[model samples]
Target: MNWMDSLFHELQTIPEVAGLAAADDTGTYIAGMNIDDTDEFAALLTFIGRSGLALEEHLGLDPLVYTSLSGKKIKLIVHRILDYFVGIRLSEKSSISKVEGRINSIVGNLDIEDE
Candidate 1:
Protein backbone atom coordinates (compact mmCIF):
# COMPACT_ATOMS: atom_id res chain seq x y z
CA MET A 1 0.00 0.00 0.00
CA ASN A 2 1.02 3.59 -0.45
CA TRP A 3 2.37 5.43 2.58
CA MET A 4 -0.80 7.35 3.38
CA ASP A 5 -2.95 4.25 3.06
CA SER A 6 -0.57 2.24 5.20
CA LEU A 7 -0.45 4.95 7.81
CA PHE A 8 -4.23 5.24 7.83
CA HIS A 9 -4.59 1.47 8.23
CA GLU A 10 -2.17 1.35 11.15
CA LEU A 11 -4.01 4.22 12.83
CA GLN A 12 -7.27 2.28 12.60
CA THR A 13 -5.95 -0.30 15.04
CA ILE A 14 -6.58 2.02 18.01
CA PRO A 15 -10.12 3.28 18.61
CA GLU A 16 -8.94 6.78 19.47
CA VAL A 17 -6.41 6.65 16.62
CA ALA A 18 -8.96 5.39 14.10
CA GLY A 19 -11.37 8.25 14.78
CA LEU A 20 -8.67 10.75 13.86
CA ALA A 21 -7.78 9.07 10.55
CA ALA A 22 -11.37 9.53 9.43
CA ALA A 23 -10.30 13.05 8.52
CA ASP A 24 -13.86 14.30 8.85
CA ASP A 25 -15.01 17.32 10.84
CA THR A 26 -15.03 15.29 14.02
CA GLY A 27 -11.55 13.96 13.42
CA THR A 28 -10.20 17.43 12.71
CA TYR A 29 -11.68 18.76 15.95
CA ILE A 30 -10.05 16.02 17.96
CA ALA A 31 -6.70 16.77 16.32
CA GLY A 32 -6.96 20.49 16.94
CA MET A 33 -7.78 20.06 20.61
CA ASN A 34 -5.04 17.52 21.15
CA ILE A 35 -2.44 19.90 19.78
CA ASP A 36 -3.56 22.55 22.20
CA ASP A 37 -2.46 20.51 25.21
CA THR A 38 1.22 21.04 26.06
CA ASP A 39 1.92 17.50 27.24
CA GLU A 40 0.01 15.92 24.41
CA PHE A 41 1.73 18.16 21.89
CA ALA A 42 5.15 17.14 23.15
CA ALA A 43 4.29 13.49 23.05
CA LEU A 44 2.87 13.92 19.57
CA LEU A 45 6.03 15.58 18.27
CA THR A 46 8.09 12.76 19.74
CA PHE A 47 5.89 10.15 18.15
CA ILE A 48 6.07 11.84 14.77
CA GLY A 49 9.84 12.09 14.97
CA ARG A 50 10.17 8.44 15.87
CA SER A 51 7.80 7.38 13.11
CA GLY A 52 9.62 9.57 10.61
CA LEU A 53 12.97 8.13 11.64
CA ALA A 54 11.68 4.62 11.19
CA LEU A 55 10.37 5.42 7.72
CA GLU A 56 13.63 7.07 6.75
CA GLU A 57 15.66 4.10 7.97
CA HIS A 58 13.42 1.72 6.07
CA LEU A 59 13.73 3.77 2.88
CA GLY A 60 17.47 4.32 3.30
CA LEU A 61 17.07 8.08 3.12
CA ASP A 62 19.84 10.29 4.50
CA PRO A 63 17.63 13.27 5.18
CA LEU A 64 13.87 13.52 5.63
CA VAL A 65 11.60 16.32 4.36
CA TYR A 66 7.87 16.41 3.66
CA THR A 67 8.35 16.66 -0.11
CA SER A 68 10.15 13.34 -0.22
CA LEU A 69 8.04 10.18 -0.50
CA SER A 70 9.30 8.92 2.88
CA GLY A 71 8.85 12.39 4.28
CA LYS A 72 5.25 12.35 3.07
CA LYS A 73 4.76 9.16 5.06
CA ILE A 74 6.15 10.96 8.11
CA LYS A 75 3.77 13.82 7.54
CA LEU A 76 0.78 11.50 7.34
CA ILE A 77 1.92 9.76 10.53
CA VAL A 78 2.18 13.12 12.29
CA HIS A 79 -1.31 14.06 11.16
CA ARG A 80 -2.71 10.83 12.55
CA ILE A 81 -0.88 11.40 15.83
CA LEU A 82 -2.55 14.77 16.14
CA ASP A 83 -5.88 13.17 15.31
CA TYR A 84 -5.45 10.53 18.01
CA PHE A 85 -4.75 13.22 20.57
CA VAL A 86 -7.85 15.15 19.56
CA GLY A 87 -9.97 12.02 19.72
CA ILE A 88 -9.02 11.59 23.38
CA ARG A 89 -10.16 15.14 24.14
CA LEU A 90 -13.43 14.54 22.31
CA SER A 91 -14.64 11.77 24.61
CA GLU A 92 -17.09 14.25 26.06
CA LYS A 93 -20.23 15.12 24.10
CA SER A 94 -20.23 18.64 25.48
CA SER A 95 -17.16 19.60 23.39
CA ILE A 96 -18.32 17.96 20.19
CA SER A 97 -20.19 20.81 18.51
CA LYS A 98 -17.58 23.47 19.03
CA VAL A 99 -14.73 21.14 18.12
CA GLU A 100 -16.52 19.97 15.01
CA GLY A 101 -17.11 23.54 13.88
CA ARG A 102 -13.46 24.47 14.37
CA ILE A 103 -12.22 21.36 12.63
CA ASN A 104 -14.57 21.91 9.70
CA SER A 105 -13.28 25.43 9.20
CA ILE A 106 -9.64 24.37 9.38
CA VAL A 107 -9.84 21.28 7.18
CA GLY A 108 -12.03 23.03 4.64
CA ASN A 109 -9.11 25.11 3.41
CA LEU A 110 -6.60 22.25 3.35
CA ASP A 111 -5.61 21.18 -0.16
CA ILE A 112 -5.27 17.42 -0.04
CA GLU A 113 -3.69 16.52 -3.33
CA ASP A 114 -5.11 13.43 -4.96
CA GLU A 115 -3.19 10.28 -4.15
Candidate 2:
Protein backbone atom coordinates (compact mmCIF):
# COMPACT_ATOMS: atom_id res chain seq x y z
CA MET A 1 0.00 0.00 0.00
CA ASN A 2 0.99 3.62 -0.45
CA TRP A 3 2.32 5.69 2.42
CA MET A 4 -0.91 7.62 2.87
CA ASP A 5 -2.84 4.38 2.92
CA SER A 6 -0.39 2.92 5.38
CA LEU A 7 -0.60 6.03 7.49
CA PHE A 8 -4.38 5.89 7.62
CA HIS A 9 -4.36 2.22 8.43
CA GLU A 10 -1.86 2.70 11.21
CA LEU A 11 -3.85 5.56 12.69
CA GLN A 12 -7.04 3.49 12.64
CA THR A 13 -5.28 0.65 14.39
CA ILE A 14 -5.21 2.79 17.48
CA PRO A 15 -8.15 1.62 19.55
CA GLU A 16 -9.24 5.09 20.46
CA VAL A 17 -9.20 6.47 16.93
CA ALA A 18 -12.83 6.35 15.92
CA GLY A 19 -12.10 7.79 12.49
CA LEU A 20 -9.77 9.91 10.35
CA ALA A 21 -10.16 12.10 7.30
CA ALA A 22 -7.75 13.95 5.05
CA ALA A 23 -8.22 17.11 3.03
CA ASP A 24 -6.17 18.87 0.42
CA ASP A 25 -5.40 22.56 0.22
CA THR A 26 -8.68 23.02 -1.59
CA GLY A 27 -10.70 21.39 1.19
CA THR A 28 -11.51 18.27 -0.77
CA TYR A 29 -11.90 14.96 1.05
CA ILE A 30 -9.02 12.70 0.04
CA ALA A 31 -9.59 9.68 2.31
CA GLY A 32 -11.12 8.63 5.59
CA MET A 33 -13.31 6.21 7.58
CA ASN A 34 -16.40 6.36 9.80
CA ILE A 35 -16.93 10.00 8.93
CA ASP A 36 -20.54 11.16 8.59
CA ASP A 37 -20.03 14.12 6.21
CA THR A 38 -16.69 13.88 4.52
CA ASP A 39 -17.02 17.01 2.43
CA GLU A 40 -17.96 19.13 5.40
CA PHE A 41 -15.34 17.51 7.53
CA ALA A 42 -12.74 18.13 4.86
CA ALA A 43 -13.65 21.76 4.66
CA LEU A 44 -13.50 22.13 8.40
CA LEU A 45 -10.16 20.41 8.62
CA THR A 46 -8.70 22.56 5.86
CA PHE A 47 -9.99 25.72 7.45
CA ILE A 48 -8.62 24.84 10.85
CA GLY A 49 -5.25 23.76 9.52
CA ARG A 50 -4.81 26.87 7.43
CA SER A 51 -5.88 29.02 10.35
CA GLY A 52 -3.27 27.45 12.58
CA LEU A 53 -0.56 28.03 10.03
CA ALA A 54 -1.63 31.62 9.62
CA LEU A 55 -1.70 32.16 13.36
CA GLU A 56 1.82 30.86 13.76
CA GLU A 57 3.01 33.03 10.92
CA HIS A 58 1.44 36.13 12.38
CA LEU A 59 2.89 35.46 15.81
CA GLY A 60 6.36 34.65 14.44
CA LEU A 61 6.29 31.27 16.12
CA ASP A 62 7.52 27.94 14.91
CA PRO A 63 5.55 25.98 12.36
CA LEU A 64 2.48 24.28 13.79
CA VAL A 65 2.92 20.57 14.22
CA TYR A 66 -0.61 19.74 15.29
CA THR A 67 -3.67 20.94 17.10
CA SER A 68 -6.17 19.27 19.38
CA LEU A 69 -9.77 19.98 20.18
CA SER A 70 -11.79 18.42 22.97
CA GLY A 71 -15.53 18.52 23.14
CA LYS A 72 -18.16 16.90 25.29
CA LYS A 73 -18.16 13.56 23.50
CA ILE A 74 -14.97 13.34 21.48
CA LYS A 75 -11.47 14.68 20.86
CA LEU A 76 -9.84 15.52 17.56
CA ILE A 77 -6.19 15.86 16.64
CA VAL A 78 -5.33 17.56 13.39
CA HIS A 79 -1.95 17.38 11.72
CA ARG A 80 -0.78 19.51 8.85
CA ILE A 81 1.27 17.48 6.44
CA LEU A 82 2.59 19.50 3.54
CA ASP A 83 -0.47 20.39 1.47
CA TYR A 84 -2.75 18.03 3.34
CA PHE A 85 -4.62 18.15 6.61
CA VAL A 86 -5.34 14.92 8.48
CA GLY A 87 -7.84 14.77 11.32
CA ILE A 88 -7.77 11.94 13.81
CA ARG A 89 -10.85 11.50 15.97
CA LEU A 90 -10.38 9.87 19.33
CA SER A 91 -12.64 8.53 22.01
CA GLU A 92 -13.09 10.80 25.01
CA LYS A 93 -11.14 8.43 27.22
CA SER A 94 -8.17 8.19 24.90
CA SER A 95 -4.80 9.36 26.14
CA ILE A 96 -3.88 12.26 23.88
CA SER A 97 -0.20 12.27 24.86
CA LYS A 98 0.26 8.61 24.12
CA VAL A 99 -1.57 8.80 20.83
CA GLU A 100 0.34 11.87 19.74
CA GLY A 101 3.63 10.24 20.60
CA ARG A 102 2.73 7.18 18.58
CA ILE A 103 1.62 9.28 15.68
CA ASN A 104 4.83 11.30 15.87
CA SER A 105 6.92 8.16 15.77
CA ILE A 106 5.01 6.74 12.82
CA VAL A 107 5.17 9.95 10.83
CA GLY A 108 8.71 10.81 11.75
CA ASN A 109 10.03 7.57 10.37
CA LEU A 110 8.58 8.20 6.92
CA ASP A 111 9.28 10.73 4.25
CA ILE A 112 6.02 12.62 4.10
CA GLU A 113 6.88 14.30 0.78
CA ASP A 114 7.31 10.93 -0.87
CA GLU A 115 3.61 10.17 -0.55
Candidate 3:
Protein backbone atom coordinates (compact mmCIF):
# COMPACT_ATOMS: atom_id res chain seq x y z
CA MET A 1 0.00 0.00 0.00
CA ASN A 2 1.03 3.58 -0.63
CA TRP A 3 2.04 5.79 2.28
CA MET A 4 -1.24 7.66 2.23
CA ASP A 5 -3.10 4.39 1.92
CA SER A 6 -1.62 3.18 5.18
CA LEU A 7 -2.68 6.32 6.96
CA PHE A 8 -6.16 6.22 5.48
CA HIS A 9 -6.54 2.56 6.23
CA GLU A 10 -5.77 3.05 9.90
CA LEU A 11 -8.11 6.02 9.98
CA GLN A 12 -10.84 3.93 8.39
CA THR A 13 -10.71 1.54 11.30
CA ILE A 14 -11.93 4.28 13.58
CA PRO A 15 -15.55 3.49 14.38
CA GLU A 16 -16.70 7.06 14.03
CA VAL A 17 -14.87 8.21 10.96
CA ALA A 18 -17.19 8.72 8.02
CA GLY A 19 -14.68 10.52 5.79
CA LEU A 20 -10.94 11.05 5.46
CA ALA A 21 -8.68 13.27 3.39
CA ALA A 22 -5.03 14.16 3.16
CA ALA A 23 -3.94 17.38 1.52
CA ASP A 24 -0.56 18.91 0.86
CA ASP A 25 0.38 22.22 2.36
CA THR A 26 -0.73 23.74 -0.92
CA GLY A 27 -4.11 22.12 -0.36
CA THR A 28 -3.99 19.47 -3.04
CA TYR A 29 -5.97 16.34 -2.23
CA ILE A 30 -3.80 13.24 -1.95
CA ALA A 31 -6.30 10.67 -0.61
CA GLY A 32 -9.71 10.51 0.97
CA MET A 33 -13.38 9.53 0.69
CA ASN A 34 -16.90 10.95 1.25
CA ILE A 35 -15.75 14.56 1.36
CA ASP A 36 -17.91 16.94 -0.70
CA ASP A 37 -15.05 18.98 -2.19
CA THR A 38 -11.68 17.65 -1.20
CA ASP A 39 -9.72 20.55 -2.62
CA GLU A 40 -11.72 23.33 -1.09
CA PHE A 41 -12.35 21.50 2.12
CA ALA A 42 -8.71 20.59 2.48
CA ALA A 43 -7.64 24.16 2.01
CA LEU A 44 -10.16 25.31 4.54
CA LEU A 45 -9.25 22.60 6.99
CA THR A 46 -5.55 23.30 6.54
CA PHE A 47 -6.10 26.93 7.28
CA ILE A 48 -8.21 26.18 10.31
CA GLY A 49 -5.73 23.73 11.76
CA ARG A 50 -2.67 25.87 11.14
CA SER A 51 -4.44 28.85 12.51
CA GLY A 52 -4.51 27.10 15.84
CA LEU A 53 -0.79 27.67 16.07
CA ALA A 54 -1.34 31.29 16.89
CA LEU A 55 -4.10 30.35 19.24
CA GLU A 56 -1.85 27.89 20.96
CA GLU A 57 0.87 30.47 21.36
CA HIS A 58 -1.70 32.87 22.68
CA LEU A 59 -2.91 30.30 25.15
CA GLY A 60 0.69 29.37 25.95
CA LEU A 61 0.31 25.76 24.87
CA ASP A 62 3.60 24.76 23.39
CA PRO A 63 4.15 22.14 20.75
CA LEU A 64 0.90 21.91 18.87
CA VAL A 65 -0.15 18.37 18.09
CA TYR A 66 -3.61 18.39 16.47
CA THR A 67 -6.89 20.22 16.48
CA SER A 68 -10.47 19.01 16.70
CA LEU A 69 -13.80 20.70 16.17
CA SER A 70 -17.03 19.14 17.33
CA GLY A 71 -20.32 20.05 15.80
CA LYS A 72 -23.79 18.88 16.61
CA LYS A 73 -23.65 15.94 14.23
CA ILE A 74 -20.00 15.46 13.40
CA LYS A 75 -16.49 15.74 14.79
CA LEU A 76 -13.68 17.04 12.57
CA ILE A 77 -10.00 16.54 13.27
CA VAL A 78 -6.92 17.87 11.54
CA HIS A 79 -3.28 17.07 12.07
CA ARG A 80 -0.31 18.81 10.54
CA ILE A 81 1.86 16.18 8.94
CA LEU A 82 5.28 17.46 7.79
CA ASP A 83 4.11 19.09 4.55
CA TYR A 84 0.46 18.17 4.59
CA PHE A 85 -2.61 18.02 6.76
CA VAL A 86 -4.96 15.12 7.43
CA GLY A 87 -8.65 15.74 7.89
CA ILE A 88 -11.00 13.26 9.49
CA ARG A 89 -14.78 13.52 9.78
CA LEU A 90 -16.47 11.23 12.24
CA SER A 91 -19.64 10.69 14.17
CA GLU A 92 -19.65 12.99 17.17
CA LYS A 93 -20.67 10.21 19.50
CA SER A 94 -17.44 8.24 19.30
CA SER A 95 -14.40 8.62 21.52
CA ILE A 96 -11.55 10.43 19.77
CA SER A 97 -8.85 8.86 21.92
CA LYS A 98 -9.33 5.51 20.19
CA VAL A 99 -8.49 6.91 16.77
CA GLU A 100 -6.01 9.51 17.99
CA GLY A 101 -3.60 6.84 19.14
CA ARG A 102 -3.84 5.00 15.84
CA ILE A 103 -3.32 8.18 13.88
CA ASN A 104 -0.22 9.05 15.90
CA SER A 105 1.24 5.63 15.35
CA ILE A 106 0.85 5.71 11.57
CA VAL A 107 1.72 9.32 10.84
CA GLY A 108 5.43 9.05 11.55
CA ASN A 109 5.75 5.95 9.41
CA LEU A 110 3.85 7.33 6.41
CA ASP A 111 5.98 7.23 3.27
CA ILE A 112 4.63 10.13 1.28
CA GLU A 113 5.94 11.47 -2.02
CA ASP A 114 7.72 14.50 -0.65
CA GLU A 115 9.06 14.26 2.87
Instruction: After the best TM-score superposition of candidate 3, give how far the Cα of residue 107 lies from its true spot, in angstroms.
Output: 3.7
Compose the digit string of candidate 1's lDDT tens values, residues 1-115: 1433444344344333213322322223222222334444445544555566578899998754321112321212232322232222223222333344444343333444533
Q: Cα lDDT of model 2 overall?
A: 0.85
Count the clashes in each prediction: 1, 0, 0
Worst 10-residue lDDT window for candidate 3 reads: 106-115
C-alpha positional error of residue 12 in candidate 2 after TM-score superposition, expressed in Å = 1.5
Candidate ordering by TM-score (highest first) = 2, 3, 1
- lDDT, model 3: 0.77
After superposing candidate 2, which stretches have Cα over 4 Å from the reference? none
Model 3 Cα lDDT, one tens digit per residue, 33-107: 888887888887778777887789899988677888777866778888766778888776866766667766766
Rank ordering of all candidates by lDDT, starting from the highest: 2, 3, 1
Pairs with backbone N, CA or C atoms under 3 Å apart (clashes), candidate 1: 30-86
Inter-residue clash pairs, candidate 2: none
lDDT of each: 0.36, 0.85, 0.77
Selected candidate, larger TM-score, 1 vs 3: 3
